[model samples]
Target: MFHIGYIRVPRSTWSVGRRFYSSEIQKKTIGFIGLGQMGYPMAQNLHKATKSTHRFIIYDNNAGATTKFTSSNSDTKAVSTPRDVAAESDIVFTMLPASAHVRAVYEGSDGVLEGVTPGVVCVDCSTIDVRTARDVAKNVEAKQAVMLDAPVSGGTPAAQNGTLTFMVGAPQSQFEGVKEFLQKMGKNVFYCGENGTGQAAKICNNMMLGICMVGASETFNLGLRLGLEPELLNKILNTSSGRSWSTDTYHLVPGLNPNVPASKDYEGGFGVSLMAKDLGLAVSAATEVKSSVMLGSAAEQMYKIIAGTEGYEKKDFSVVFRWLGGEKIGKGKGK
Candidate 1:
C-alpha cells in the first residue's frame, strides 16, 4: 500500500497500464470539472486558495464557462476533457448537475476513469443518488484510486463566499486526508460514513428543505390572504416556532431578505427542477430503506408541478411561494 497524504491506497488494486510513480504522485496537481453556477465559484475559491502551491486544471462542457474561468484566474489551465484533467492531476473534484451527468463525466468515454492514475483522489461534490455514488466509487477503486462522495449544502451565495458545507462520505482515514483540501472551498466538512452516505445525507437534507419551503410558502400565502402584512408575518415566523432556514435565511417573501433569490425575482438560486430532482432522490432512498416520508413525497409532487409549469421550471425553488399565491403580497412578483 502507498499513501496519498493520509489515505493509504493498496497497490494490489492497480490495473494494467495505470501509472503509479512517486514523482507523478508528488506533483500536487488539482483538477475541477463542471463549471456551473455553484461549481464555478467553488472552483474559483479553491484556485485562489491554492494557486501558489498547486497547478490547477479545469474542464467544463460549456466553452464559454471555460473561457471565463481561465480568463479570470491566472495560472489556471482549461482542459478539453475530463480524461485530460485526470491524467494531469493528483486530485480531481467534480460538481456536475445530476446522476447521469456525474456518470458521464466519470465513466463515459474520455472520462475521468480513462486517465486516472493510481493513488489519485477523486472528490465528487454532486448531489446524485446513493446508488450512483457508490457505483462510481467502486469503479474508482477498481482503478486503484480513492473516491469520495462529498455533496455540499448552501446555495449560490455560500458557494461564492466559500462558506458551503460539505457532507463527505468515505472511510474515516480518507475523510481526514481530504478534509484540508475541502476546507479550501467550504467552511464545514463532515464525515457522513462509507461510500454513498454523503449523497444520502444531502438528499435527506434537501427533502426537509423542500418540505419546509412548501410549508412556509403555504403559511405565508394564508397569512397574506387573511389580511396580515408580509413584513409583520415574516417577523412573527422568524422569531416563532415556524422559523427554519427556509423562513429565516431564504424567506420566499421578496424584499424581506435583500440577499436571497426571493429579492432577485427568483432567477439564480437553486432551481425548481433541481429541488424536484433531489426530492425524487429522497423518495427513492426512503423506498429503498423501507422508511416513510409522506411529507417528502408530497413536496416532491409540488416541486414537480412548479418544475413542469412554463416559465417557472428554471426559477428558484422558493418560487413555490408565488406558485402557491403569495406573489401579490410582496413588491416583487414572480416572472
Candidate 2:
C-alpha cells in the first residue's frame, strides 16, 4: 500500500496581481506519499509544522495506515493515487521502500507525472540507486516540474524525532527554495550536488554503517568468548580509538543502550533486509565505478545471509550481533 499527504490552499491566496498584506503568507498545498515506518512519523512532523491554512493530503497502499493517520490528524485529506496527490499539491514528497517502487510511483500509468503541474516541486526521500534517482529526476524535469533526490539518514528514531539528516541532490537555487520545508522534518539539510548525489551519499553511509556493525558484532562476540564482559568491553572501546557510531551511539550489545534496537530484540529500527538492500546498492555502485570494496562486499554478503535467515530478515540490522554469536544480555541483566 502507498500513502500520500496533500495540502491545499484557497484560490484567493494565488489570485493574480493583488496587493498582499505584509503578514499574509501564501498557503501551500503539500503532498506526502508513502506512509511506512519512517514516512509516517515524517509526515506527522511536517503536518504539525505546516500552518492551518494549508490543506494536507495523504494516500497509502495500506488503508490501515491512512485510516490511522486521518484518525489522528483530522485535517488531512486522503487521496486514492499518486496522481491524485500530484494534482492537488504544490510540493510532493515520496518515501518509498525501493527503487522499483519509486519508479512505479512516478512513471506508471496514472502516476505522479500524469497529474503533476509545471513548476511543482517534487522531492524523493527514498534511498534508491543513483541511476534510478537521476532517471526519475530527468523524467520529472521533462514534464516541466522540478525534482530533487533528497534521501535521508538517521533511521526510524531520527524520523520520529524530526532529526533526520537530509542529503539533497539538486541545484543550489532549487535546494534553497525547499530548505525550510525540509527543515520541518530534519535537523541537517545538506545540498549534496546534482541529481543522484544524495543517493550516493546515503548508500556510502549505509555501506560504512553495515561494515561497522559487523565489525562491532565480531569484536563483542570475541570479547565475550574471551571472558571480557560486554559492558566492560563496550566502555573500553567507546573511550578508545575503537569508538565509532556503531560502538558508541548504536552499540550492537543489547543491554548497552536501552534506546537502540539491540535492547528490544531488534524488533524496530532499520531492518536487516533494508540494510542488505543498501549494501547491495553500494556493491553495485562500487562495481560500476570500478572501486575496490573488499570489506563492503564481505559485509554485504553477511547482511544477505542475515536477510535470508528465518526470523532475522525483518528484525533490526543490529541483530547481526546475535547472528555473530554475541551473548544476549537482557536489559538490567548486564554489568
Candidate 3:
C-alpha cells in the first residue's frame, strides 16, 4: 500500500514493485557518485566505517576529484560514468548538488537506471526539490528497483567525522533495508515517511535556518549599535528568550562563535548561494501548497542579495553578517 495525500492506495493501484529483502546486501558492491565538498568526505567515511572485505566504485564529473579520492582510497576505484558505477555495484548512493544534476545522472542513456538490475536499491542523499525526488523514485521503482530519498545534514565537518544526520524518505519496509548503509555514513537516521518526505524535511529545516540566522545577525547588530559589547550581548541572548541555534550555538557574529565560518572571514561552511537556493526551494514548496511562508520569502530575498555581493556567494552564509553591517563582505576588504 502507498499514501497519496491523506488517502491510502493499494500497491496494485501503482506500478511500484515489491520490496526485495536481500541478505547479500552486506557483501553487495557499493557505488558512490558526486564527490564534491560534502560528498567526498561522506564517501570517505563510508569506506572507513565499512569492512575491509567491502568493495567500492565511485564517480564524479570533476576528474580532479575522482583522481584525488582514488589516489588515497585503495579499496575504491573511480569509474567512467554513472552507468559504469551502477553496472558494477549492487547498491548505489548519490550525494549530488542540484535537481538538474540528479536528473541527468539518473535518467539519460548513460544514467544509473539504465545499468541497474532488478531489486537493486538506489539512495539519493542530495538536497533537491520534492517533485524531483518523487519522480526519480518512481522511475527507479518502474525498473523493479527500490529508491530512497535520504538527504543529510551537519555539513563538511560532521561528514568528515562520520556524525552527519540522514533524514530518510522511504516506505516502512525499505527502512531496514538501508539502515546499515545510512548508519555507516551518519550518526542519526530518521525515517520521514515515503518518497519525497526526506527532501521536504531538509527544505523546511534549512528554511528555518536561513530565517533564524538572518534574525540573529540583524538583532546582534542592533544590540551593538545600542552600545552592548559583542560578548555581553551574546551572553544575554544565550540566556534570554531570544536564544536559538543561531544565537546560542552557531552565532553569526565572528568573535561570538570562533568555531563557525564567520570567525574566519567566512571561508568554509555552507555557501551563501546554497542557502539562497534552499530558501528558494522553501518558497516554491510553499506556493505549491498555497501556504504562506512570509519570513521564508523575506529570508530568500536577503540571501539573494548576499549571493549577489562580490565573492560572497562562495563564502560562508554567515557573511550575511558582514553585509548586514554595511561592510565590504568580500575578499581584500576590512574585517
Best by lDDT: 1
Model 3 is weakest, by summed lDDT over 10 consecutive residues, at 16-25
Q: Give lDDT tens digits, candidate 2, residues 50-162.
A: 84646789878899999999999999999999999998887889999999999999999879999997667899999999999999999999987789999999999999999
Model 1 C-alpha lDDT per residue in residues 33-59, reported as the tens digit of each score: 999999999999999987866789999
Cα lDDT tens digits for candidate 3, 113-206: 8888665679999999999999999999998778999999887767878888999998878788688788888899999999999999999999
Off by over 4 Å in 3: 1-26, 326-335
Who wins the TM-score comparison?
1
lDDT computed for candidate 3: 0.82
Q: Quantify all predictions' global Cα lDDT against the true fold.
A: 0.88, 0.86, 0.82
Candidate 1 or 3, higher TM-score?
A: 1
When 2 and 3 are scored with lDDT, the better candidate is: 2
Question: What RMSD does model 1 have?
Answer: 4.5
lDDT of 1 at 300: 99
lDDT of 3 at 170: 87
TM-score of the candidate numbered 2? 0.91
Give each prediction's root-mean-square deviation over alpha carbons: 4.5, 4.9, 6.7
- Candidate 1 residue runs with Cα over 4 Å from true position: 1-27, 330-335
- What is the lDDT ranking, best to worst? 1, 2, 3
Q: In candidate 3, residue 126 scores what lDDT?
A: 94
- Predict model 1's lDDT versus the native: 0.88
